[model samples]
Target: MPADVPGSRSERTEGAARPGGVASAPEGGPSQAVDSVLDALDPDRDRPANVIETHGLGLSFGSKPVLSSIDMQFGRGTITALIGPTGSGKSTFLRSLNRMNDKVVGFRHEGDATLDGRSIWDPGTDLLDLRRRVGMLFQRPNPFPMSIRDNVVAGVRAHRIAKGKQLDVVAEQRLRKVGLWDAVKDRLHDTPFRLSGGQQQLLCLARALAVGPDVLLLDEPTSSLDPISTEYIEAMLAELVPALTLIVVTHNLGQARRVSHRTMFFYDGQLVEQGPTEDLFERPTNLQTERYVMGRFG
Candidate 1:
């Protein structure tokens, strides 16, 4: 695996090491671990601008096609929104990026998806580490059955990025980043189920961030939240860009307009249109895209 790729095993090992010590914090303390985590997540300055690319990608379950001939590139530190009516293959494409559909009963794919200029399905690629670099947040908040703090640091622990007191640092830093620290600080050990729907989602976001991913894949992230919570998540997303890439699958056209720099329209298993967010929404080149954006039909 390329050492420069975020979450690569080599980067993780090197970043977590002190001059003469193992892959853990030195005498400099938890701050060192925190800094290491952040450094590891940063994309290599000389890396290709497009963090992910799909080439003639297609998908099927058994013999039923889901997505076809989908070619796209997701620029580093940019947000692209996938938008379309239900059953339009938007979610399927999103899931394919991280190979989330591989275990489905009859999932099959064509062509390729690449990360950092290498095929994601390369024989040498490590699935667990690939998932670490390409994290995901689902349609609903699915916090683990653990304490709030534990929920936040779950990935960090799983990746062995930090441990002992360092886990606390990672948890607090991530929770604060997602604006959940102040709300859940007093109940760090309490079960996450007690949090409100919005709070739980934020907690999930924090958990995703703790692993220091290079790309984040979101599927209808704000769909379940109220207006206020939705606003909160949207704002948080805006703050993450230029540091982490985001690909979001959403049904809400308005949310797509608000949070994405680029937008793609998928219909009947084909990519109908894609362009800058403003242009795609305001001057859609395709008749179908124009109608859908104008509320003629989903």
Candidate 2:
């Protein structure tokens, strides 16, 4: 399940987890240069395509299995929501998308997960590149103990993507994308801890966006915020989908229906159903899905 988002629980299942680390460039200098990462964020890049796909995927930690025979697809510049009861492996599935489970002890998997048809599990895969293409935000906003400007440019600098004025431009553009630049523009040099929880979460979002990911993964991003903050995030997400793919794990079914173009329901480590958001909510093919969506059971 999730680590910091209180009340946003996850079932232990058989396996799960991942934390980020800097990865050396592949045979080449870097998978993407500073300018390329920045260019990815341009609003014009928004378009529909199958950006992520999983086939016959299965995962286990030690001997316990958390996911099995799962097949799913995520479209570029679209939003898809994963919903299920506690311990059903929602977070586990999300983590696997970016190999986040690599940090978990005894974690292993079978089957294929691809980004643009390239296997993510390949030994030659560039971890940093994968992360840049697929950025993630946790349930709560965990800002680095640094100034807002530094927080936004952390990834960019780590990868040596940009410098000087260009770096400043990246910071400003991402902050604006998340609607935090205007609020924090004057205080860009101030520490992030000084911001309210809502602002901090948005800051975290800006940090993720600074790298310009092709697919964005959020694990209950709004679960810890106040209603007003939640509204802000949801609105921002709507605006973002036109440029990057978004896969969100949320417990709030209402929120799922409100924000997703496609809805997926999981149970006991398996995907029970998935379809267009309206069709799934209005007419689920599976009884469990219907019951869950109807508030009959989680």
Candidate 3:
């Protein structure tokens, strides 16, 4: 297997000490996950970009701040990693990107998050459009109870993508992009629960991709997978990054250094610091960052 998985770690890293000396990362880079399939994105050489930006972004639950004054920008077509110990609100921050936080009755926040400069908080903003543009994947692979094919195409169906053959074509394309197509093609008529945990997660990813989102958000996406499956998803993310803005919140420090273009350190609901992955990892500006990354505590 080729070892160019976009975020391949240095051999000296402890994770590389895999049994039988298997490649610590996935095979042939993450690009292989979706190489043959083409996204429906229009080709405009000078088209404007779609970046996720926020300023003074803060969230509070009943007067208790969960995320306070976070100012960060995630570049379009790049992956940003949010890392910190437990209770740092990493997941909360990710959900806030799409106003998923608003679903909770007591959720309150101050500041604005803009997707491609459009304020997501503005009452005039079309929430359906915003959510469609910024899709999300959960930690566990929770595919619907229906067939694998049906699970992948749910979002497409929600938006009413064409019909019949058109939907099938799009579903196949997205499933193949996430490496689940061949595995489930023959089983498209079978129930999703019949597939392994890993495949279910990939199917969830296919569902997110089916809508042609500009940004993808993951919250501890591989926490339950075995190492092989974990590596597979990591590789898949690398392939997906070039066409989508990716923001990942994980407690795994190694995952951050491997796949992130920018790394942000959060502590106790506050952003301690953020910068280029290498810069932040090598020399953290805040004491909290240094302590957390060095394993003083989770």
Model 3 lDDT per residue over 212-287, tens place: 8989999989887887887788888866755677899987888788777778999899899999877898898888
The TM-score of predicted model 1 comes to 0.86
Question: Which is superior by lDDT, 1 or 3?
Answer: 1
lDDT of 2 by residue, 125-211 (tens): 898899988999999899998889999999999888999899889999988878787899999999899899999999999999888
TM-score of 3: 0.86
Which candidate has the top score in lDDT?
1
Name every residue pair that clashes in candidate 1. Answer: none
Alpha-carbon error at 221 in model 3, in Å? 0.4
- For 1-298, candidate 1 gives per-residue lDDT tens digits of 1122222323232322222113444467687787676557644545877889999999999999999989999887777999998999999999988999999999999999999999999999999999999999999999999999999989999999999999999999998898888999999999999898889999999999999999999999989988788877887886676578899999889888877778999998999999988799999999999999998997
Residue clash pairs of candidate 3: 2-28, 5-29, 85-298
The per-residue C-alpha lDDT of model 2 at residue 233 equals: 84
In model 1, which runs have C-alpha deviations exceeding 4 angstroms? 1-43
Clashes of each: 0, 2, 3
